[model samples]
Target: MTAQRSGAGANDGSTHRPRVAVFRPDDDRLRDAVALLDSLGVKPVADSMLAVEPTGALPRDDAAFVVFTSKTGAELVAEEWTAGEETVCAIGEPTAAALREHGISVDVVPETFSSTGLVDALGDSVDGSRVEIARSDHGSDVLPEGLWDAGAYVHETVLYRLVRPDDAGESVRLAAEGDLDAALFTSSLTVEHFLAIADERGQREAAIEGLRAAVVGTIGEPTRETATDHGIDVDVVPHTADFEALTEAVLDRLEGE
Candidate 1:
């Protein structure tokens, strides 16, 4: 069920900067998000949501093509695996940049930066070729399924598991209390984990209500669908699927209100 987008204009005639919750993993990503939000004049509530747990597994070496879907996956793979003759592909610029940071050359980066886009970018070239997808356990099934449909022999390696941090419910408390003015959900898993924590804290309904009243932003369609499925009214989704874009778009919406 989709609801009409609503603003957190709860502070209509006040001087309070919107308190936007960010659920980036605790690391440079979280810090960067905080800096971006602060620069945009929003009070960022830093909530570390996803934590990377490396599985210590490497991609199969005999594949004809290797695909990476995230910066974390790229970094993990680069720690132990070196790109050889297999063509390397990234889902987006950030993953490609991470690969390059480890001296791995990226061969393909789709214009649209999604599983469907990668399938279209690879086109008929993967026919009968062995392609290996290395990513976290929470990866969407779209990429592997699309590759198999494209006549590629696909192998998936779980390079890491994205676990919710032990102490991650601060934002949930804030939302349940109607203190959050906006929230940036970067992935579907983030949306799920956020609600899981809310449920744990016995504040799921209250948190959902708070988010619906606030400006909810997602990174892409998948994330938006996840939030909407959970009854959250998503107000902003930038054309670009990155934290900076998502944050800026949510900030713009908040400012407009």
Candidate 2:
């Protein structure tokens, strides 16, 4: 069942409408999440951690396989993909669909949307193969490293750069005022960039203390360590490391507490 909260400006007076800060890049995912929050009478403020920009280059290598881990990555490839010799692999359904939308057929798609999941799905397939991974400039080294260890000749290229958002000043001001009830961190990059913005504005500690946090929840040791280093206690992390899971976890935590 879909959970509902009741409070002033919410469904009823019993539940308070919480203002959530979204610390993601300005993209479709962020827009969808914001719309969902609006439907629930919750206010969502954009504290975008990164801004995306295209790197003008077409992927040309007719490699054995191509890998994509995010919808943005897939879209960037589709913008310049014109080869027929390579098979495409996606980390999630959305990325696969993006490829299909570009009239490209995906050869492999992991059931889960994590790097570990992708590695498991590609287990023996990548051995002795040449795979090209297209992703953001600031992505993790998990996929490339794992593939290399498994005997694949992995080639990587950055298709986009995640820069700090231009309106970050407004976000910092709002956070300083304690207007945001909570902030969602979907990636370690989001956590890092958000803190960087806070630190630049001289409001790091206050921002951390004021807002409740929920991470998209990585199983990676490094992700957990990064969160800890920033002094941000992760309030809720779902079993599945996806945005839907993150939302449910946040809602459950807010309802319970």
For candidate 1, lDDT tens digit of each residue in 1-257? 11112323333534466788999989889999888776665678999889999999999999999999999889887867888899999999999999999899999999998888899999999999999999999988889999999999999999999999999988899899998899999999999999999888889999999998899999988899999999999999999888888877887787677
- Runs in model 1 deviating more than 4 A are 1-14
> Who wins the TM-score comparison?
1
Global local distance difference test of model 1: 0.88
What are the root-mean-square deviations of the candidates from the true structure over C-alphas?
A: 4.6, 3.3
The TM-scores of all predictions, comma-separated, are 0.93, 0.86
Clashing pairs in model 2, backbone N/Cα/C closer than 3 A: 6-15, 7-12, 7-15
lDDT of each: 0.88, 0.72
Query: What does candidate 2's lDDT look like per residue over 177-247, in tens digits?
Result: 76665566777787787778789889988777665332223323446567778787766656766666666
Number of clashes in every candidate structure?
0, 3
> TM-score of model 2 relative to the true fold?
0.86
Q: Which window of 10 residues has the lowest lDDT sum in candidate 1?
A: 1-10
